[model samples]
Target: MATKPKSPHQEQPKTAPPADEGRFRDDTDVAVDAIHQRIVGREQTEPEEGFEPPPVWVWAASVVLLFVMGFYLGRYSGSWSTVAHEVESPAAAAAGPVKRTVNGTVVFTGVCQTCHQADGNGVAGQYPPLAGSEWVTRDAATPIRIVLYGLEGPITVKQTAFNNKMTPFHDKLTDDEIAAVVTHIRSSWRNSASAVTAEEVADLRAKYGVRGSWSAAELSAERSAR
Candidate 1:
């Protein structure tokens, strides 16, 4: 005989309840609701403490601190002195009186200092020894041609050979400037030639207006021959 159909209760397999699923769902929903309430409450609350604004003095202090920092930074960066010097006018600047005699010395230092050192002893191979130079000792006119027309290529000074060239000063220097510089150079070294007068320089410049630098062949101990 067919066995009797199992009862629905017997047919259904016994299953254990899902552990913590319903409770977890309930707890999660509660926590979410609480968070939403907190958010809404925060939105409803008045803006907190009205941002206790800093005092006017504090703002002023901050501005002062920024200015001070910028000033010191500029000073340390070396831009301050440059900017300040640029901003100040030449007349307003702190300085001393410039000596007229120093002008000659300064010109010599700038132009002749390279060949003839500060002491006026020239380099052996590159430049002729200015000290005790016979050419410099000869006359004012000889040095004038040397300055105005310049010297070039294999010059013999006091039996010493100097092959280097000396640049012309006609265009670069004024007549007075040439006079002053030549006078200074001659007197400073072991040379004892008299000061080169501007009249002499002017005469030479007028005489040799467009001439190139003189070579040793072109130069002579006799100024009139040059």
Candidate 2:
């Protein structure tokens, strides 16, 4: 019996198409559609080159306006440097003996005590003794002038030439406080002069018209003429 026809020994040739052919066509079509959409979107979003930027003059004017406004506002608000530098009031015009003995006392406590000593006998040669000094004991004008205007270059006190500078107390002290301090100083150190009044100081300031210190020569001339 012929064995059932011998099954074909050789393998049959593959009959099936590539498994991904339809999938590849579908993916390619989707990619093309996506590319078309992107091109359309970009065209809609981008502005044309013919659209010009704002004018240079407009920008420049805007900047200038801003700066001017800033300057004006700063000035009006008292924030400007020039306003700060301008003096509000003269320091010598405020506060005096009646209003501020404590402050006056404190000022002397720190500085005058050093040279004048606790008893007001100033250091010899290096510092002129304030005790019984003619300038200290003289009219209140002398000491007031000295305090308001600093002494400098060279000065003669008590028959000795004192070539040292004394810093002006005008800016550092109020008028009343200066008067108080001068009053305290004069009366304290072996001195018996009258109290320096703020009114007197105001008059002196008006008369001298000096914003700075006075030298002994200038003082002497004023004295001799008087």
Q: Among these predicted structures, which one has the highest lDDT?
A: 1
lDDT of 1 by residue, 123-179 (tens): 877788778888776777887888887887887887888898788888889887888
Measured with C-alpha atoms, the lDDT of residue 92 in candidate 2 is: 46
Query: Positional deviation of 96 in candidate 2, in angstroms?
Result: 18
Q: Rate the local accuracy (lDDT) of all candidates.
A: 0.74, 0.71
Q: What is the lDDT of residue 43 in candidate 2?
A: 26
User: Which digits, one per residue and each the tens of the lDDT, describe model 2 over residues 108-188?
Assistant: 788577766777767777677777888787777888888788788777678887677778776666677778778888887
How much lDDT does candidate 1 score?
0.74
Provide the lowest-lDDT 10-residue window in model 1.
7-16
lDDT at residue 40 of model 2 (Cα atoms):
46
**Can you tell me which runs of candidate 1 are displaced by over 4 Å?**
1-102, 221-226
